[model samples]
Target: MIAIDINKRIGRGPGSFRLQVKTVFQFNSVTRILGPSGVGKSTLLKILAGFITPDSGLIKFGDAVWFDSQIKYSKMVQERNVGFVFQDYALFPNMTVAQHLHYGSDNADYINQLLELGELTSLKERLPRQLSGGQQQRLAILRALSTKPKLLLMDEPFAALDSALKIRIMERLKSLFEEQQTTVLMVTHQDQEWEHPKNQIFNLLSQED
Candidate 1:
């Protein structure tokens, strides 16, 4: 189980917002954080991922204490077994798709499986700049999964794809998650995106209740 008990102040000047997440996320399930644009949804995910520190509270993932403000114990982002996929699809423009997958792991068989699962085999030689937006997004996700992380965090992963492509990718993701059993925490503003099976949806703004 991943338990996040935190309270932090965010933003600048008079337009700042306060973020408080005193909740527990179960294991091996997809938890979708739903809210408006500037409601600190991504910030909460960042804190959980150990990219941001809170003024007070503790974060425990199973037996590991990832962060504890009272004790001043905080793990680095790399130390946590997390796979993060940003909304913009952060990929090296000069590197080929094959190179990206290989960079995460040296296992050839795993790389081949990722290529097949992501439908990226055909585009292995293509660079990020050469691929379409959706293709780039697929590559980004594949790269993250290559790390074999216990927890996967995605921010608006399907925002750049069309509805048809989104549906197809979502199906593929469901299969991949089932096969790997990786815990996923995804943030999205669209309600229709969280209709997948076995997913727990939580509205961030309503979290206080």
Candidate 2:
């Protein structure tokens, strides 16, 4: 399980607010974080991923302590073994689709499986710039999963895909998640984008709240 209680100041002027969040996530479960703009939904994921440090709080995952304020201790992003799919699909422009996945893991069989799952086997040799927006995003997702991280964080991962394609990818991902036993936290503004009986919803409060 993941436990957190943290706070941070975000932005400036009318768009600013104190982002105070406290929550626990069950292990091996799927969670959807929802909120309006400026609610710090993405920021929360950043904090979890170790990109942003909280002013004061603690983050614990099972027996491991990811962050601690009193001791001034915090784990590095890479040390946390987290797989993050950024909102911008942070791909290496110079690298081919296969290279991105390969960088995440050295297992040839697992890499090949991921390529096939994303239907990217045919385009493995193509670089990010050569692929469409949807394909690039798919490569990003596949790369994130290549490591089989314990916690997978995604920010608007399916934003660039058509509804039909998104559904297909999501269905395939559901199976992948089960097979890997990975916990997921996906941020989305559109509620209809995901629907499953096992999905737990966490709605962030606006600063006004």
For candidate 2, list the clashing residue pairs, or say none. none
* Candidate 2 local lDDT, 40-114, one digit each (tens): 999999999999999899999888999999899999999998999999998998899989998999999999999
Q: Tell me model 2's lDDT, rounded to 2 decimals.
A: 0.89
Go through the candidates in order and give each one's C-alpha lDDT.
0.85, 0.89
Poorest lDDT segment (10 consecutive residues) of candidate 1: 200-209
Residue-by-residue lDDT tens digits, candidate 1, 82-107: 98888888898888999998888899
Error of 2 at 201 (Å): 0.5
- lDDT for 13 (candidate 2): 85
lDDT of 2 at 110: 94
lDDT of residue 200 for candidate 1? 88
